[model samples]
Target chain A: MALEAEVWSDIKPIPLDDGPDPLAPIAYDAEYSEAMGYFRAISQRDERSERALKLTERIVEYNPAHYTIWHYRQQILFSLNKNLNEELDFVKEQIESNPKNYQLWHHRQVLVEKLMDASCELPFINEILNDDAKNYHAWTYRQWIIRTFNLWENELDFVNKLLDKDVRNNSAWNQRYFTLFFNPTKPTEEFLTQEIEYVIEKIKMAPNNISPWNYIKGIIAKSNKDIGILEELCKEIEKQDIISPHAIGCLVDIYESRARKGSATDKEEGIRICTLLAEKHDAIRKKYWEYRKVILTSL
Target chain B: MPTEKEFVRDKHISYLKRGLTLLPKQYASNDTNRMTLAFFCLSGLDLLGALESEIPEERRKTWIDWIYAQQILPDERNPEINEKICGFRGSPFSGLPFDPNGSRESRLPFDAANLAMTYTALTSLLILGDDLSRVNRSSIINSLKYLQKDDGSFTQTYQGMESDMRFLYCAVVISYILNDFSGINIEKAIDYIKNSQSYDFGIGQGPGEESHGGSTYCAISSLYMLNKLDEGLLSKEKTLFWLISRQESGFQGRANKPPDTCYSFWIGASLKILDKLELINYEQNHNFLMQTQAKFGGFAKLIDNYPDVMHTYLGIAGLSLMNEPRFLELDPAINISKKAKENLLNNCAFHKQK
Candidate 1:
């Protein structure tokens, strides 16, 4: 017996230790079974009719990931000319109930796309991210909102606010980079300069945080800027405290870049630092540093 | 966190086995992830060294048949059209034809195969001792071409959905399991993996994304399976350093992220493939994972939480990597029992000879 409705009882939260919860608290096991049996019988018919749609709605209320229910609901929506705004409200509740379900996210996407507007999406994403800043589904859906709706104008500010709340939120950093990368005007040299300064300031505030350091490195590598900035930054960080692995790693990148341009002095220093890194600080990657040694010497 | 240190293998086995027959209420939301749930049980039991005895004889046959029934074979009647979308859907949620031998031409709109399910379904079949002779390898390989984007990352399907490391890993797995890489653009795929390496040396979903333990595993495991682990990798020491540091009582997927049950497998398996599994603090990880075990059975995302299928399977896999007693050896690269991997390899060789 699954879910039935021969009698009424107080609805209660199902036990955490189990699965396939009843749609609602029922009077008897037979009642739970009867209701679920009714839902399944109607579902198997797979009709696009009103009764079928209502059955799916009830079943999906219990299990949103029963994606066939969502499919039929969508079909029934179009057929019945249901109020989409009301449907949107219904999806919001489902998403809140089970935010991790992939079907709920996809269904929302279809609804938003059909509406041809993303005004509520930014706020919706903002609300969801507020629940869990690094929720991958929320972030992916946010990205989709930006891409489909051309909402890039506010992305930089969005990322900045999130970063301010938690500097270590790497998802926000990635969003910052994505926002910059996809800017319609194309990130210019001046913009890159500003971007690099923004990242360096963040790095100076928290040198141990790797994401911002990587953001600066990305900006530098993309801009083909003089590696001297990293050298200066590394020196400044050394002044603050013993250099971090990220700083040393950036120095290695700079020297390797220099060595690639055939600076014999830089090449020797690269091999020497790599040897130090191999032997000491970054010993976890000893093999890689050793490989770098062989490559630098051969060069 | 727990008073006892003994691994509750029996409780976990019961939890997974019970799930197969009657899913608990907590998992009602994951109705579509039923295939993944099955993978957890089959693989979990295999890891426990209890698969053969725990699964009833009738169930083994029925599970294999049910999985095959989910496969997306090309329509015999409209080969030209259905050929383009051949793979396995995640579940019977599509309400399509369920035939191991029935016509593949259901003409259902959402009858296409899902990449994650395809990966899990094949692995589950192998765990169940299915020879995979009935798996439509050619159609799946052919369907992979449609999933790949111009940049070499793959979407979950051909419907222009989100593409990232998850599907990239799936595509690589499907290719490697079938012993054919022709459908994938190896060089481009390698480029995508390389680009995904963030400043911290961990891999992410795509270029410029945040590094995550799961994506790092996918990226590393994909490259290893493709024979390009070293060549495509960047910042090796940084990546290794980052991975080794993830172990703070089990493992976390990223910096500042709390240790979770699944990362123990994702990061541990990555370290194993990198030949640095020995670097982790075994006692600490063991204690952490033990803390996450549910009283009734199974492992949760973190200590003192409800257990779920994904985390429980991975928790066992992670412990297996540590060679936890009574658990079977895990072939870390593909997250299967070493015995299952041998079967797959032998199967591949047998097919090659033909």
Candidate 2:
């Protein structure tokens, strides 16, 4: 293989200068510097040719987080009208290696948008999420793909599969909420009831899991439904020999909301649960529980 | 498996000093973000109250000069294009000849300023006691308008990178440092932050994204800088509850995530900003951080993990929040020492007249 300088022998490499008072300069690998040197020289020349595109690949391999390089690559792809399918493959490989890289995801989004095809993204993102379920970039990219491609058909099933694997995966729970409620049309009452039931069952599986509790509350809030809708479920979880602090916390929120509307008895119940949480069950956040208690008592 | 029972002050200071001088080869990946790394080391030392004692005065001056060299000012020849790119590049990665005086005749393509780098560069300069004499304040502020999107999020660069809470925080900090909000639409940015609050009440990187500890810090801090912290959150009480629940031992970025050292600062600072710092179990938080303390120096993300500059800086800052007497008081919103913030106020030109 020809060296980067030799491959771009026609262009003079702009050598990096660390200046007289350089601060914490990295001891860059010789190959990396040589590639970047040629990149700088060609990029300055406004060269958006095939060789420049190839140089970007080498530089990106060395550092995928370089947004400028990625931007240049996008420009070259558009200027050269290069095979975006092959470009997608290249980006997939980069994402596989660096799933958390923001630039890689953005580049992929640009390519998929330009291509106007997102058929391959779901499986690609699913594969990545399989490795790290809570990978933020993957989930966010997945959401974008789902929305852009209108691939909401089977998303609920996908999210359920993830939740089945790890019921505590907050990303999966968030995805479920997004799939069900984040559309042009609001969720129907029947659909909202089904989601609530689904979440309650998941909550039963792991009474301490906060994701489902949050999801159920999200459904109630988004629908503008009564918080009291979950009172029975909260009571059922609270009656268990080993009580869930979240369940009791839910009870406190429910009663507190009612108390705000001038129910004196609900205010007393809210304060009682807050006392229980502050003194026992969730003593780690004693102050927060006490604060809740104070707010309810004042109401 | 013996663990450090207290904040290893001297070891951490040594670690930051080494970070300032010569980073490990693995950090070459961070070559473009050298400014952020430098900020971590410099600010970490400042947080430990070791900046003056550890780094000599002349060396500190050189470091400040070196950081200023990375500033990307407007090119006289290409005013329109250069206006959007004027701020600070992370480092001299563009291979431009070093002009310590910053007298570059022409701006190069792809030598764009990153929002995060600009924020760190400014804070690093402040930490090093540099006056704002050399910063092209207007050009940087001019660049911010182009960076802000229609939805109120700010991208990392004019070249268009990921727009999220992270870059928005950087833009807000840059504006805060320059003491100007004219470049960005404050109302739109505030709306973007409000929209990013997840159903769980913790903020996310963007709308529909999961609430993360890091993004929560960015969102909360941005709001605090904008003077909108009280009204910006979707539900202040629920946001506080979500943040409070992050403390299992050290703080996790999200529910069910394992405790990490960096979130101790991320979530800890958010709590401090919300005036819920007293709610933290300081003893447990300190104990968890101690477990992640490397025997050699610095704090790792978790027990037995290798330490990096970012985590080390944040780890020290986290301990400082708990009123650890060995550390200096931290200004949580900016993730810098209170002394450094005061230096910005008293020394920088923007705040000097005020």
Candidate 3:
């Protein structure tokens, strides 16, 4: 790309700019200088440039809080013909400096995908997932990576590990459903039972969460292989709800859907449920409208 | 006894007051994301005729100063790149300099010409009842011209980002509010909005994208501002039909999406704009919104969730549109403080030069 003209006048780098300190500089507010240096370097490079990378390293080393600089650095590195390993190391350095930056964490996942494409074996993804099991980006990206690599066979174990770490991750719950429903290679019924039981336990512990309820709803909707198990799950929903009003409508929708599919509830039963719901919750009058339709249609 | 209108006024006042109270005292400097919310809360109050007893002028002035300071200047050319006309940074990121004009700032080029911010800033100033005399309209016009992409859709800024009807609407609002259209390539932009309308009669984020309630509002509202509402671009029957269809008790922004409280204003306002709001059962819609009200006196995206300022204000605004007996009258044009808009119109007429 043809470069735009330089509009800025050069000013002295400030009194604190005691030339580049070679030793791990105790402290340096080199944000402005480093940022300018990176911009200047990128402006000149016809192809991918390493000069911007070097400046980024210096910038991050001196001022770790400069997150935008890191983002800029990532862009520069990604654009450059840098190897995947180099990109990974650069991101690792950034994450180590500022682990709380969700954008960087997301970028790390992007880097991993690129690395995987390059056929580079890396355990960094597992390490990050293990560190923060609830990290939505990490879980989502891992799933993407697994799906791309056609590694659904090992996904059961991967999910087990994730749940072992954090049982309450909604992203994990979603992942489990995705794997169970969409995975070409399904796990054994016993393994599925255990996972569902664990999910049930988690739900019992925290009934307010919509994810577990949604997960249960998804599980019941897909497979009618075990009617007894489905009955038990329905019983659990009725008895165990912590009374989160938001979850009530979602739960009702699931039940209504099940009723429509002829999962046990007859047309009369569905109408009774809708009538009861209409009387009980004024909030979901719109939702009951659907149940009313289902009852009318069934009749 | 308060009249129904007075009750609505009280509700609006209480809602806006709660929104203001929820604002964190100190946000990150670059965090201009809340500027619109701040403008709406303050301006919304002013419009509701409830601002004076609530937010004082001295505090409002301070907010005005802080918002204006966020405007990136055109004169301070980046030492490395001069052609880059300085624009408002949404929020000062970690590496960006505190100085309004500083070199080596890690600026999101996407904010290079934020039509939304420009509109908000202008609207905010107008809402605060500031004279248009001091605003640098020429610089804004110049920056705005650059944000328009060749495809007719406006990039949020000069840097390549999401281009859609939203920004196009923003550009129109900014230009129109400033009383200047020189900044925008109007023909191309109108074409973009036209192309963005889905077969469903709702506006999507862009062409081939899913239609959303918010984007639909933007598209329709922009057309309304541009004096193109009745044009062949949007058929009244189809537009009204699509807008009315959004109501399932309350309104959802799109197909298969759960109703959010903000959509009550967004899609509701769109229906009103189309003069088809009567298609919705107003009592049902009002009841649905009332259910989403948090026990603590603010509205959430839905009931049983924590209340937020945006949803709270929007819910009230939605109710206001329904002619709910208790809220203040709204001026949708600038979405300005209706009171401020009135004040401005009165002042303009009072000082008529002719």
State which candidate has the highest DockQ.
Answer: 2
Q: How well does candidate 1 reproduce the true complex, by DockQ?
A: 0.18
Please write out the lDDT profile of model 2 over residues B1-354, one tens digit for every residue. Answer: 565486678998899888888887788778889999999999999988899998889989888888878888887777785787888889888767777655345467777888999999999988988887899899899999999999999998889787889989999989998999899999999999999998889989888889999999999999999999888997898999899999897889999999999998999999999998898788778889889998788989988999999999989889899988868899998877899889888888898875
**Predictions ranked by TM-score, top down?**
2, 1, 3
lDDT value for model 3: 0.58
Better of 1 and 2 by lDDT: 2
Q: Output the chain A TM-score of model 1.
A: 0.82
TM-score of each: 0.81, 0.97, 0.55
TM-score of 3: 0.55
The lDDT of model 2 is 0.87
Task: Compute the lDDT of residue B188 as modeled in candidate 3.
Answer: 81
The residue-by-residue lDDT of candidate 3 on B198-246, one tens digit each, is: 4445666655344567888888888887888766255564456456546
Compared with the true structure, what per-residue lDDT tens digits does model 1 show for residues B37-138? Answer: 888878888989998898676668777777887777877766768766677766554544456642377555544677888898889888888888888787
After superposing candidate 1, which stretches have Cα over 4 Å from the reference?
Answer: A1-46, A79-83, A226-228, A231-299, B1-6, B53-59, B72-113, B142-163, B181-201, B206-208, B228-245, B274-284, B323-326, B348-352
Judge candidate 3 at residue A119 and give its lDDT. Answer: 41
**Backbone clashes (count) for model 2:** 0
lDDT of 2 by residue, A54-165 (tens): 8888787778888888899999999998999999999999989988888899999999989999878888988999899999999888888887878888888898889889
The candidate that wins on lDDT is 2
Q: In model 3, which runs have C-alpha deviations exceeding 4 angstroms?
A: A1-75, A78-299, B1-32, B76-87, B91-113, B232-234, B343-354
Candidates' C-alpha lDDT:
0.76, 0.87, 0.58
The better-scoring model by lDDT among 1 and 3 is 1
Q: Give residue B202's lDDT in candidate 1 (0 to 100).
A: 84
